[model samples]
Target: MSGVLVIAEHRQGELREATLEALGAALELAPQTGRQVVTAVLADDPQALAGPLMGRTHGLRLMAHPDLTAFNPEMYLPVLEDAIAAAEPGLILMPHSSQGMDLAPALAGRLGLPLVTDCIGLTYQDGALTAQRQVYGGKVSETLVLKPASMYVCTLQGGAFEAPETSAVDTAGEEITLTELSPAHARRFVEYVAGALEDVDIAAADILVSVGRGIGGPENVPLAEELADALGATVSCSRPVADVGWLPKSRQVGTSGKTVRPKVYLALGISGAFQHQAGMKNSGTIIAVNKDPRAPIFAVAHYGLVADLFEVLPKLKDKLAG
Candidate 1:
């Protein structure tokens, strides 16, 4: 009857946002399942990576080994399997990123455990864990539950959960190091390639003014830019904008694009599709402007304005300028 185990992911000597978000998901599930939250990080410097997550978990397991510095499924599988064996967690959580996508399935297969991938929602009910997954590119939702298994593995969708705030806790994390793991020579460490060419990371932006197909055409993209300028924010868009050559692929925000956690997200003309929401749902404030009153974006949006972007943008720009 122990707690959940979150497999933390790090890159370039820093913990990724998905790691904290997975912790957030674990924190939410803990109350329902009545289990403590334990996080496991496999890295060269586990102590440095585990610093920020100190009070956040009931225990922090650092599987530090030189071979784990880089992300390779060949090296990660055995190390993670060892960590899971020691933890014996009821549930294991991994981020649904490139690393998790490669690692989770193989790890689950190796351990003969049931795994649910790209889960948007997770809850404990009837003494079983239920996960919600979006099918058909966020059009349909299916709930999955595993039975007769002592342990379960789940991959949390990016930006699906909020990052937990730092709180001072009296409890200190218990760190354990595993020395038995050795590098799997099947794959060798290679150089890391940058995903975006731009220096500005949309994922790191605090305020983002995003547009979708509702902006009518590519010409209206400048209006979103103007609004972003006035608000001292960055301009981002949905996949359609980038698809039509209106914006660069780097500015696209969705399941296939960069996941952002901006402080204020102004989504204009976006239909609030699940794919788009998957990237920005964790924003501190989501102000959605769409003519359709029934748009799904409003469900997660903190503020909603039912109106045309043509009229709303000018007024917003004028007000902000004044």
Candidate 2:
């Protein structure tokens, strides 16, 4: 294996945090699997996006073209194929985001390499890579092993890896730019259709009181609201709460919804499924209140109270109010 190649992702000219997180994963694996880390930044002008990543990788390949303003399959596909052929990296890591979802599978299929998506854990042992991902509503975990080949491609789950800390100190890393842009394409880029603005932006909330199926009924949701009001926190929910129409989809948190990193996340009557945990697991302090002590939410919580939330809510709310 030559090295690890990280395909960086960006949006609207700004580098996405997922890029740094992918780099972090690549950096960790480089020692175990590769001798170097090469990050390929595909953009119109990679200068701005490549700045923070200067000392972060063994090499930065700035793949540039005018049509690269927005993500286009036709524009990105050929260039990435060429880069892979040139780099011959043992491992290829990218974000499991919208762009990555589109790119990774197609990249692997075209090149006949092993591929995995939305991986939460990755390990290299005995010259093979093992990927861990969620299954069956996050209740079951699936471990997939990829046998060694020329290389392997993987898309990482959001919030799974911490973004790497960066500095301006010089390293032995090299910077290289490529201008071999795909000239002709049948499809052209179009304007983005944005979703309607939500009344509340839960992603920006520092404190979130999130509910789930265990909340029982929609009528009982006010208990959570009251607690949120008393604590000056925002109300969020797991997927079931939103699916049952108890809350708007905007307030939902999980893989199929939004990812949040609040200062405090209070899970009330929530089971703490893997999908739900993936969204808010990185909160500063996690406190779970559930009747079932074995609820999966407790596994990631910093503080837990195994009791009925119906009994806990009013008391906790009043205590905060007092």
Candidate 3:
């Protein structure tokens, strides 16, 4: 039986939730393939990723390299490519992060393998794995099946799979051997530059209040900020608002921008376009305030308010303040 390989994603000694999600998908794929799931962590420090896989059911491997200290395509891709060759797994799963987007395609090109990017769901059908992916900015979903290959590469969408619980026995004294790769050509990381709008990571925020074109103009953003302040939430905006320079691109929420899964997402004066919804649909509780009752944002929203945000926001803010 061919094994399934899950790539662990981490940065600065912290494992990404998407890695666990990928593991969940790997677990499901393993039984169908009748093989054990194997997880591989590619990093400078393999020990840092031990916590997430401590209680995992499948086999784990660590691929460590000095060049992998920071994400660089030239260095990390070759190491991962070598790992895949060594493991000889049937399927390779990775998170659909910026790093994954860069590496998955390059790896696929290097190995001449079929690659499926941004998969939201996976299922086994007739001895083949079918992956579901969003098309046209989440307006439609397409299922893809790869031709028979030694190995397949796929990037799993974030929040598509829930993290599984780790058992005490799973974390006990189990350690996988670490493999080192010596690449003829390596990319070196020199310096890191932070984005000017670094505070715009809505995914890390507990509360997010996002605005759309319905807010009318840039001047009206203060009103939205007021409501956000009252609710103790960070302010975000849709693509249009950000494109028009009303807000920075970092604050944009859509398929072209950031995908955030905040605890509470408040959509103010925003018409929920499919692109925008894709970013925040995974949020815990979505509350949309739009004057148009026909706005598509209400479809996925847990709570909907059909009224002008200008009027609704002030009342809600005052009530909260009181």
Could you say which candidate leads in TM-score?
2
What tens-digit string does per-residue lDDT give for candidate 3 at 121-182?
Answer: 88765556678987754555698886656678899887678777776225323333445555
Candidate 2, residues 108-205, lDDT tens digits: the string is: 88788899999988888767889999776555789998877768999998778877768522434444465566634667778987655687999999
Where does candidate 1 stray beyond 4 Å? 27-35, 125-127, 133-142, 158-189, 195-209, 213-235, 254-266, 273-275, 278-294, 302-322
Using lDDT as the measure, name the better of candidate 1 and candidate 2. Answer: 2
Estimate the TM-score of every prediction.
0.73, 0.83, 0.77
Q: Rate the local accuracy (lDDT) of all candidates.
A: 0.83, 0.84, 0.79
Give residue 277's error in model 3 in angstroms. Answer: 5.9
Number of the top candidate by lDDT?
2
Query: Who is ahead in TM-score, 1 or 3?
Result: 3
How many backbone clashes does every candidate have? Answer: 0, 0, 1
Off by over 4 Å in 3: 168-186, 195-209, 214-216, 219-234, 248-264, 269-285, 290-296, 305-322
- What is the descending lDDT order? 2, 1, 3
lDDT of 3 at 228: 82
